[model samples]
Target chain A: MFLLQLRNELRKLFGKKRTYLGFGMFLLAQSAFILVLKYGRGPNQSMMRMMQGNGYAAAHFFSNLTVATTTLLATAYVLLPLYVSLVGGDLVAKEAEDGTLRMILSRPISRLRILLIKWLAGVVFSLILILAFAVFGACFSRLFFPEGGLFVSIPWDGVFGVFEGVEGWQRYAAAHLVLTLKACTIMSLAFMFSCFDIKPAAATIVAISLVFISKIMQDTPYFHDMQGWFFTYHMNVWVYFFAAPIPWWKVGESLSILAGFNLTFFLIGSTAFQIRDFKS
Target chain B: MISLRNVRKNFGGQRAVEDLDLQVPAGEIFGLLGHNGAGKSTAIGMMLGQVWPTAGEIRICGHDIISQRQAALRKVGAIFETPVFYDYLSGWRNLEILSHYSAPTSRHRIGEVVEWVGLTGREHSRVRTYSHGMRTRLALAQALLPQPELLILDEPGDGLDPEGIHEMRLTILRLHREMGLTILLSSHLLNEVQQLCTRIAVMKKGRKVFDGPLSAINKSQSWIRLRVNDFPSAVELLRRERLITDEREGSLIAVAPGSGTEHVVRCLVAQGISVYEIAPQEQTLEDSYLDLMKFDGPAPSGKQQLQPSVLATEH
Candidate 1:
């Protein structure tokens, strides 16, 4: 049954026109970013040049790529949530709105099982989106830089750091993995909002609103006391992976919090969906 | 078999269904007849365990709908007002998704049901491309994929062409006769229900006003038409003799409830009226339904008075 559901989810993700829209947006954004980095001599190139003067070298070039890619993917902090929202938001609400819930619910399976399948499908879609970003980001970044190590320039602290002498492939792989996990957390949050709303637009709005609101609140002085608990505060936790010696404590805490958020919201979504009247 | 005992449902303070009790026997076709907002959908929802009843018990195949929902739902298949499918998926793929919920249904069964609903050649076509009738057939195909014991169809014939309606009727009859699947169908189309259902329940304002065999309900009222050369004199003669109470329908006079053709013919001829035609009017399910619901208050005591001949057919 689970396999059947997985197959159905995969089919829906691949077959729907909207799925291609998401991929198209990702391609467009990645290409534009690559163009700016290679030909436009944008802020990223200026930063790279400044880091090079501060004792940065080829051994740490991947580290610079990671920072640049992470900054570029932040744009997805807005775009990807909308995509996730469109898919997940329709998980249950679309069925109800379209009057398909009645036929789906009439099957022998329990409502919990149906909801679990939908939630899992949403997660799978989210995973695919993250993977797309990681793969595209890597191709674009490598095209422009063509270097072996990342040069990190911290403007605020007046310090220059480099992951010198590290294997470029390993650094890029680790950076992509960390960014993918961070995007997973955001996608999961958007999915939770989707479960609560019947309208795809409404779900997307709410999910994006939460992310943007949390970002603003984390930076606000009044919200200083609650910064550590906000999911947005840890959105940059992937940066810790690039830090020398790696801040395992902050990394583990952020991962744990994100995991907890995912589980909590997934559970809430399944429960509400299981009990909700399928009638629109 | 499905049974509802004193089922009541409310949305906020407004009652959607109230004190509704009905039992649909195994392998029989039971029609639920009502107007818009008559709580037919709500009742179906509660029976399917999609919506909780504010109060009452719904049992499907002897399993409680609330406490043992999965077991109850296991024996049921439903098609709500419209055909709902993943528009992006092929018709075959939609059925494949539903097949997961039931006992491991085989590909052969899926193919069989697809053919049964007459979608064999179009099974691979995306559902978004299907016509309304085709979608309806696909929805019915999905419902039958599980081979459930009970089928609850709400307005299954709505939007269907005459040919589609005929095909649906045949399909439903086959399910009952060959598969022995009990069916609870709700529709506003009176003639279809009249032709299909063995038993029916009628609702008005969220309350059940009539329930029992179709014959008994139809037998409660009768109409007779008397055509006379001197229409006014014949009408006055019939009224004076108290043989038939009537109202005008064009030049023809329609007699009231108990007036039989034989009685009207005898009375009119004895009164020296020139009777052109004395025919027994066919009492339709619609007329019977209107008569049943005509009363503003509680139904008058004792089985509604009908002519002896009508009573004879009723029993």
Candidate 2:
């Protein structure tokens, strides 16, 4: 039944013309980011001069591009929520809007099964979108800056370090994986919101608003007491992977908190969807 | 079999369905007759478990709709209003998705239902391009794909043309005759219900005023049509005798319930009125329905009041 539902979800995602809108936007954004990183001149040159003055080699271009690409991708967090909303928002609401809920619920399968399938399918789509971003970012960064070195900047610590030696690839891969996981957590939250709302647009707006508001609130001194509970405070947990010795304690706490949020929201969503009347 | 006992539904503060009690026997087509706001759709929605009833019980095949929803729903199939489907997917694929939700249905069964609905040649076509009639057929195909015990169809023939209506009627008859599927069809069209359903329940303002076998309901009312040569004198004589309540169409007089056709003919002849034809009209389901509605209260606007026996026999 799970395989059957997954197949159906895949068909709906690819079969409908509306599904392409999200993918198209992702491609366009990635292309624009790549173009700016490749041809545009900015603080990269100024930082390179400072690095050169500090006796760093020019071969550290790849490390600089990695930093640029990471920052650019991070700044483009808008796409993450949009991608999650596109798929997640339509999980159950679309079925009701289309008048297919009656046909689906009339079947022998339990409501729990349907919710599980839709949630999993939404997760799968979210994962695919994140992977697409990672692949595009990696290719574009490599094209502009092919030389290998490690130029790490600690934004919160107000310090910069350059490691021009072997084992740079390991560090880059580790950092990329951690960043992907962080984005996955955001996608999962958006999906849970999708299951709760009836309108796709409304669900999308709510998901984006939650992330945007939390981020803004976490930066405020007035919200100092509430910052620990905000998902936004842990949004930068990916930075721990880039630390010299890798702060396992902070990373573990962030992962645990994210996992807890994901599980709690998923449970609430499934329970509500299972029992709620789906008349639209 | 499907049964609803004291089922009531409220939207905000307004009552959509009130104390609705219905029992549809297995292998029988029960018609739900009502005006636009007569709570037919609300009752059907609750039966399908799409909306929870504010009060009372709905049981399908002996399973409670609220407590044992999956089990009750497993035996039911329904089509509400327009036949909405995934326009991008082919007709065959749409059925496949619905089939996955139910029990594991085979590809051969899908092909069979497609053939059953006369969409064999066009099964591969995208549903978006299909006409309204074709979509209705596809919807019926999907509903029947699960081979459910009970079928709930709301205005199934609403958008069909003459030939489409004929074809739909034949298809519905085939389902009941061959497949032995119990059907509960709701429609405001009296003639359609008379032709299809053996029993019917009529709703007026969220209340069922009449519920019984179609034949019995039709038989409950008496109609007398008299054709007299002296139309004015016959009308005057019947009015003076208080034998008839209304007269219309110049030559035809509609007599009251207690006045027999023979007695009216005798009185007309005694009054020197030449009686051409005097016969008791066979009270049709439509006539009985109109009479019932008139006694209950004024029917809501735009209600289709079908003609009596003539229309039923002619068709």
Candidate 3:
């Protein structure tokens, strides 16, 4: 029964034009980034200089895997949260505003089940959005860059890694998989706000605003000691996949905290939705 | 099939439905009539489990709405106030989606219901392309999708042209007469209610001002209809004798309740005026509804009010 209803929910979700906005935006952004990397000399010079300073052959590191991984890092932080929040915020609030929630609730199904199904649908959408990002990155990179070794560096985090052969591609896939966790977390936050008596846009805006604020607080030197408490800090757990030997412990801790966050968001959202009156 | 006991709903400090105890028996078409904000929609909402009652219990088909809501709503289908749908989806898809919430309905059944509500050819069209009348029909189709034993419709004829209203009325009547389904319809369209419902309850403010069979409204007034050969002479005699207070058409007379039919007949015959027909004049539903709207006091507990009688006499 859950699967049946989830299918129905997915149909409703994908039937709307707004749900495809993320896919389109990612396609455009990835294509543009690849085009600039191919045509612009400044970015290549900076990359070559950074590689030389770190003592690696710059040409060997400028691979399809490197470009794709870099594209995910550059775009996932900003674009992923925005699009996931947009979809999650609309899952429930839009229906309420449109007056369709009343009719839907008029059925024999419990409100809790409906909320669960919708939340699960949002999670699925987040996963699909991340998958699309990965696919687009790989395709656009292959179109312009040659396949070679992988090089990744986040200077502020004091991380630089190099890998060749199957290990780099394996890490690349794992990174995209872990990136889904970040998308789901932001989506859940927006979904919680969506259950409240607010408009869809307001829900999305509030969710995105909270993410930005958390990110800023995490970056602040004053809150450096409490980094583990901020979701924005834990959201960077995917970046660890690019680390040498991989920090499994850090990944596990971040995953546990995010799983807890997801549960709490679902609980709060289901409760609010259960108690709300569909007076519209 | 439907019952409410002392149900009350308050939005903030404002009362939407107060002490509303109503029963709609099996296989009866019950009309819920009220003006705007009279809480007809609110009461229907409670019955549908859309609005939680501030006090009291509502049961549908012997299932308690609060504790056994799914069970209660299992046999009930409704369209409260406006019939809203997913405008992006086609009518067929909307019905297909809505029908999945209950027992799975087959595509053949969906097509049959589409034709039942006169949306056969247009079921493939997007709801946004549908007019108000088509939307109402689509709402009817979805409500019938569950093959509900009890159908609660709030203002089904609202925003429809006369022809559309007529079609909706016919569909409702067919559902009741053919399917033997119990119906609780809420509307301010008195004529439509009068034609479709066998029993009705009228709401005022947030309370039930009157409830009984359709015959009770007309019976509240003790009026006698009369026809005479000499219309003017009979009218003059009756007026002079102070028996008839109002005249109707060319010959009919509104005999006062104080004067018996015997006295009016005796006086008219004594004046050599031949009486053609004499019977109690039945009031229209409109007349009874207007009379109830003029009522100023709370309804008697657990009893249908006959206050409209006094108001009818005053009329």
Candidate 4:
């Protein structure tokens, strides 16, 4: 029964047009980046200068993997969070606003089970969005650039690394796999707000606003020492995958914190959902 | 099949239901009648475990609603006020999704219910394309999917046309008589309640004003309708002789309980009033509902021995 309900939840989530907004937006952003890199200007000047200074041919590193990784970096912070929050914020609040929650709540199932199923559905959606970003970026970039080596640079996180052949592909895949943590954490935050008595749009906006505030605080030099306390700092730990001699301890710590955030958000959402009247 | 013991619900400063005690026995079609804001929906919401009662206990089929909510709700099926569904999904899909919330329902069973509600052909269409009557039918179909012992329908015929209302009434009657499904039907349509429910409870301002069989309301209060040549003279004479307490238009006269219609006719004849037509007028559910709402305080219940001539007309 649980599996059947989860399947139904997935079907319901994917059945709506809004569910594909993230996929569509990511596709457009990735395609535009690929076009600019392939036809307009070859990779960024600073990235080229850094590679040349490191004694590697800058042109040799201008491959599909590089384009895909760079495009993901540019959009993951803004577009990915926006779309994840959009879906997560809608999972419960939209049903309540549409008055379907009253009918569903009238059934024999427990409220806790209903919320768990919905949260699971939101998690699955987050995974799918991240998967699509990886696949689309890789596929679209391959159409415009040749496959060769990979170069990654995120000066903010102080990560600059170069790899070749299988190692480059493995790291690229691992980076996206780790990115799922950020997607799920942001989604869980919006999902927690979705359980409250608020509109879907308001829930999404509030979740995004909090993320923006956290990012701003983490990025500010004055608060650099305090970055470890911000959720955005942990969320950006996915970028650590590109660092040479990757900081395994920092990665583990951030993963633990992200998992805790997910659990805490779900518990709070379940509590709010259980006590709500669902008058609609 | 259902029971409420001193149940009450308050929405902040306002009370939706105040100390409501009700019992619906097995195999009985019970109507919950109330005007807008009388807490019929709130009471039903509590019964279905959607709204938490501020105080007291509610049980369904011998299970406590708060503690054994899943068990209690398992035996019940409900169509709450304004049936809502996923407008993007087809009616068939909607039923399939909603049915999974309770027990698993077979496709054949869903098809049977769809046909039962007269929505067979339209089940393939999205709910956004459905008419109000079609949506109501779909709601009924979903409620019937789990083969529940108790069915709770709140204003099921609310926005239906007269024909649709009549059809809904027929469906309710069939479910009660053939399937032996105990039903709690909340509606403002007194005529529908009169035709369908065996017993009813009327709410006025968050308090249950009346709860009894349909015949009891008629039996508690009755009037004598008369068409006389001298309407004014007959009313004056009846009032002068203390035979009638309330006089209404069309010469309807309210006599005290135990005052038979024949006796009233004899008294009118004795007063030199020619009564062309005289007949006993059994009070309808609507009349009783209006009377109950008119009172500022708690109205009389079935246990009360009411004198219609005095109490019915009193504001």
Candidate 5:
């Protein structure tokens, strides 16, 4: 029964035209980047200079690893949340607004089961989006820049920190894999808001604003001590995979915190949803 | 079988449903009759576990809703107020989604049910394009998909055109008779209730004003109106005996109190007053409904329903 309901929910999510709009936007962005990276001399020259400074001998420094890392960072902050929340935030609130929640609740099943299926479906959609982003980044970037040794400087603390990497394709795949937790966390937050009696757009906007506020606080000097608790701090944890001698402890901490956030958001959502009367 | 015992629901100290107790046996089409704001919606919400009751226990087929809700809800199918659907999805998709939680209603069964509701070709269209009547029929189709033993609907014919209303009535009738499905109908339409329900429970201001078999409730309260000779003497004598409360157009209307209309006639003839004509002033279910709603209001009593008489100028 659970599988049946989850499948139905997946069908409903994918059936919407808006779901494809996100895919199209990401596809265009990735393809455009691929075109510029291959032919644009300014970006290529800058990469060549950075490679020389970082002690790399390769003429082209933008490999599959760098491209995947860049894409994960570039889109995960803004575009990913917007698209993910578009569906996640609408999971329950839209149903309530459409008055279908009352009709659906008329069945023999429990409210918790319905919410579980929806959340699971949202998680699945998030994974698909993350995987698609990875594939697009890898395929498009590799078309322009071959598989070369890669490196990127990180703001580990208050100074410039170079984390040189030559893990080849392994790091690229791991970077994408680690991002699922981040995507799930953001989508779950949006889904938690969706369980409320608010409008779908309002839920999505609030979820994005939460991330925005968290990101700002993470950058604020005074909030350095509190930054670890903010979700955005953990959301950017995928970058750890790009570092040479990958920070497994930091990555595990972020993964655990994200898992906790997902569980908490789900609990809050399901509990709130159970208490709702659908006032329709 | 269904039973609501001492059920009460209040919204912020304002009572929505008050001490509502009801019972509907198997194979009975129980009409929940009330005007708007009569707490019918709130009571139905409680029964469906959508609204939390301030106080009471509701049982369906002997399973209590407070603890054994799923067990109780399994046998029930319901449509509340307007039939709600996913406007973006096709009618087929809507049913397909609904069938997931319902008791394993198969795709083949869905096809049969869609045709059963007379929505064959239009199943591909989104529900946003469905008319009010079509939406209702679709709701019924999904509600019956589980083959539930009990079907509950609130104002099923609301907003339907006359023909649409007639069609909805026929659909409900067929579902009840052919399917032998127990039905609970909530509506302000008295005639619809009269035509459809065998038993009824009337709500007035969060309270059950009346609950019984329909025939019995209507039969107990009706008038026996008579047009007679000598209006002045007729009024004086009937008033003296307190048999008639008021008169109209040279006639005296006796409150039958249910049966024995002949006794009033005999009493009138004993006075040697010539009886010109005699007939029972038919009281419709509407009148009965009105009386239930106005039970506490200062309206004409059974006797006071009689208006002041006019003298027969022909004499």
Candidate 6:
């Protein structure tokens, strides 16, 4: 029964023109940016200089682009969250705006189940967007720079880290798997806000604002003691995928905290929605 | 069967529906009538479980709405104030998606219902392209899709033309007569309900003011019809003795106060007029409603104040 409802939600989610808007934006950005990175001359020298130790000496084929490290990270940090939040923020709030929420709730289905189906659909969409990012960013960047060892750098600590002699395919696949977790977590937060009485655009704006605020607080030296508590800190856990040996413990801890965040938000949204009067 | 016990709803500090206890039996077309701000919509909302009742118990087909929400809702179908749909999708797809929650429904049933509501030709059009009346029809189609035993419709005639209103009346009548579908329709359109419903309840400022079989309010014993041997003598004798106050259409419509049917017959017969037949015709529902609206005295307690004798003398 729930599967049927989820299928319906997915249909409504994809039917709107706005759903394709984000994907189109990503395709354009990835193609245009990768074009300059590959063909542009003097600019490439400054970028390649960031390569530590040998300094682009043993670079594979042309230079620094690896699906796991460079292109994927560029898309993941900004574009993915904006797009995921759009659909996630729309899941329930759109029904309310359309005045169809009353009709849907009047059915025999439980309120929690109805929302769960929508949330799951949003999670599926979020995962699809990230996976597509990995594929498109990897394949598109490959046209410019040859497949090479992944280039990874920690924030502020510009000390470079490289994964050499490792199969790029295996590393690329692992990085996407971790990225899916991050996408699902951010999308779920947006979905929780969508359950409120506000409009979908407002919900999307609020979700994105929370992400930006967390990112800022995590970067600030004043919030060092509470750094681990911010979701923005954990959502970047995919970066660990490019380390010399995958830090399984850090990945596991980060994923657990995100799972906890998803559960808490889902609970709060469901309770608030069930108690609200649709007529009001 | 639908029952509401001590139902009350308060918005912030103001009350919307106050201590409303309504019970409508199965297979009856019940009209819930009220003017603007009469809490008609609010009462319907509580029945549909869209608004939480501040204090009460509502049961549909023996299932409590609060504790057994799914069970209670299974037998119920409804349309709130206005019809709303996904404007992006065709009307057909909207129904297809909504029917998923009410599982085991068929594509054949969907097609049949759309046709039933007269949307057969335009079912494939996007809802945004539809006019208000078409959207209302689509809402009706959605409500009928569940094949519910209890249908609660709020202002179902708001967007209809005169002909459409006539068709809607027939459709509701057919649903009740043919399918045995019990309906509770809330509206301010007096004539619509007066022509269609078997029973009705009126609301005033968040409180239920009157409820009873329509006949109780519309029927009048004072307006008697009679076919006599001599028309002139009967009229003259009744007028001379002052037995009737008003006469119309070859009948005494309003009998004089302190006079009964027996007195009129005796007066006419004593003057050599033979009375053949006598029958009472009713005033329209409009007349009864107007009278109720103007009354500034005590209110009734549910059905207790609905005694036939008390209502019969209001005129």
Clashing pairs in 5: none
Task: Report the lDDT tens digits of candidate 3 across residue range B1-315.
Answer: 999999999998999999998989999999998898898888887887778899998999999988998898887778766788888889999998888888778999999999888898899998999999889989988899998999988888878899988988998889988998999999888999999998888898999888888887766645566777788888888888988776755745666657788999899888888988988767798966776787756663223436323453544
lDDT of each model, Cα atoms only?
0.73, 0.73, 0.86, 0.87, 0.78, 0.78
Per-residue CA lDDT of candidate 2, range B1-315, in tens?
889999888878998888888888898999998888888888887887767898999998899988888788876788767788889999999989887787677999999999988999999999898998999999898888878889999988888888887887888899899989999999877888999999888887787767778877765544456676778888888889977766655755566656677778788888888887776667777767766665443222122333322222322
Kindly report which residue stretches of model 2 are placed more than 4 angstroms away from their true locations once superposed: A50-58, A61-72, A150-197, A271-275, B226-259, B263-278, B282-284, B291-315
Each prediction's TM-score versus the true structure: 0.87, 0.85, 0.89, 0.94, 0.87, 0.84
Candidate 3, TM-score of its B chain: 0.81
Model 6, runs deviating above 4 Å: A52-54, A58-69, A157-160, A164-166, B219-315
Candidate 3: regions farther than 4 A off: B222-282, B300-305, B308-315
**Candidate 1 on A128-198: residue-level lDDT in tens?**
77777767776767666665555544442232345544543455456557666656666666666666635
Give the Cα error of residue B284 in candidate 2, in Å: 4.1
Candidate 3: CAPRI quality band: medium
**What's the CA error at residue B55 for candidate 4, in Å?**
0.6
TM-score of chain A of 1: 0.85
Q: Which residue runs does candidate 5 get wrong by more than 4 Å?
A: A34-44, A156-166, B121-129, B224-241, B244-278, B297-315
lDDT for model 4: 0.87
RMSD of each: 4.3, 5.1, 4.4, 2.4, 5.3, 6.3
The prediction achieving the highest lDDT against the true structure is 4
- Kindly list the per-residue Cα lDDT of model 5 for residues A122-205, writing each as its tens digit: 999988988888888877777766776555555553222233344556666776787888778888999999998899999899
What tens-digit string does per-residue lDDT give for candidate 4 at A1-280?
Answer: 8998998899889989999988998999989888877776445666677778888887789789988999999999899899999999999999999999888998999999999999999989988888888998898898877888998878878998889989988888899999998999999999999999999999999999999999998989999899989999999988988888799999999999999999999999889988888774
| lDDT by residue (tens digit), candidate 6, A183-237 | 7877788888888889999889999999989999998999988989899888877
The window of 10 residues in a row where model 6 chain B has the poorest summed lDDT is: B306-315
Residue-by-residue lDDT tens digits, candidate 3, A1-280: 6787888889899989999999999888888877777788988678778877888887888878888888788888899899999999999999999888888888888888889889999999989988888888988899888988889998766567899969998888898899899999999999999999999999999999999999999999999999998998888888888999788998999999999998999899888887776675
